[model samples]
Target: AVPEAADVDFSDVAGGAWLMDHIPWTEASHRIGALNATAEIARVLRIAMGEAVLSVERHTWRLNEGVTQVWQYFPADLYHLSARFTPNQGPHDQQAETHQQARPTDSQGG
Candidate 1:
């Protein structure tokens, strides 16, 4: 997913402006269902925030505040399956030539 222009700014007003680009809940729901069957959707959602990720189970449902809570048929077996939000370290910092170079003479005891 491409980074949304709004995500680059941290100001409240700037961030709030992004609400206008919010995907329709109905459409997200459909996509979630379709994704559950074929993809690891949590990774896709991570692109938007670039910080937090969203995870969901096929049996889960959205309850409120864009939050999805797990639903168990048995009351005694009720449990909460929450999303694990992990911060991304952006891209790795490395040069192609660094990896291609062999060990130096010092390390090789030459």
Candidate 2:
């Protein structure tokens, strides 16, 4: 259950928008990879094996409380992802920030 959403009414705006507006921003983690469709992915996305896909999983949290988890899949040939980072200038414990780019994958690969 979403403990953070205990008393929230999501009748006006979209649920996602409400979550973004109401929940405090904390941190998110992402995992991305190119893979063949798994059974679950095939059922949801109607994809087949040998059909390469780009999978992205993200989990977000507010301090120690888990907020949301999401997974997105795209045909590998139709998209590309790239990220660039500048060295962290903040405290040693903080992570470096990343700038991301998304475009069509080339014939060779992403």
Candidate 3:
């Protein structure tokens, strides 16, 4: 990717952006993309139900109310639930069968 732009001389290029003369400007865009992926991984680890929120305020500029809003992964609730639960519908069928067994008998002694 870097090499493609390296071949194009600034004078040969159509645009007149000041930073276009420097290669680091192109590199900076790539750097930002890499950081975004890392940030997403960090985000997933810290999320819980009803915890994430975005508060944007408009003043002199569209400022981020809390730029450092980050989360840590809490697997305790999910881990325990997964460990105790089986991935089958057999339990539901068994529960219905139990209800049938517990029905009141009319012939029982009063």
Candidate 4:
């Protein structure tokens, strides 16, 4: 069964085909009932895709026009998340060596 739409937990998102399954939902109208259904569907997507991005299919049968449409991309790569980390290296503590330490030549060292 689907969970509520209040609190969205992305970690529990399972990788699968959410759109293919819940697109033809009969209650996708502008009414309150339809709004609730849309919210539920979004919550599910957040869990399954592990991403809270909006994805609307513009080239579909009914849904068209360049509007907001939430869809799944993939598991979030910690490195790709610019919000938490920079592209320099790993976490804040683990940093990449900017330059190799100067080494002595064969004849320079005994």
Q: In lDDT terms, which candidate is top?
A: 2
For candidate 2, the TM-score is 0.60
Candidate 4 has a TM-score of 0.16
Per-candidate Cα lDDT values, in order, are 0.30, 0.71, 0.31, 0.33
Model 3, position 103: C-alpha lDDT score:
24
RMSD of 1: 19.4
For 31-96, candidate 2 gives per-residue lDDT tens digits of 887888878777676557657888889888888788888888876766666544457644445453
Give candidate 4 misplaced runs (Cα > 4 Å): 1-3, 14-24, 27-68, 71-110
Taking every candidate in turn, the Cα RMSD to the unseen true structure, in Å, is 19.4, 6.3, 23.8, 20.2
Which parts of model 2 are misplaced by more than 4 Å?
Answer: 4-12, 84-110
Candidate 4 lDDT: 0.33
Rank list by TM-score: 2, 1, 4, 3
Consecutive 10-residue window with the lowest summed lDDT within model 1: 71-80
TM-scores, all candidates, are 0.17, 0.60, 0.13, 0.16
Give the per-residue lDDT digits (tens) of candidate 3, residues 1-110: 23444566668565324224432231111010111224454466454444432322222111322112223333232221112334574643432110112223367541
Task: Give lDDT tens digits, candidate 1, residues 20-102.
Answer: 35431221231121112113333443222223322333221223335223421211112223243336533343212201223
CA shift at 30, candidate 3, in angstroms?
15
Give the per-residue Cα lDDT of candidate 4 at 97: 29
Clashes of 2: 0
Clashing pairs in 4: 13-47, 13-48, 14-48, 54-69, 54-70, 55-69, 55-70, 56-69
lDDT of model 1, residue 23: 30
Candidate 3 steric clashes:
4
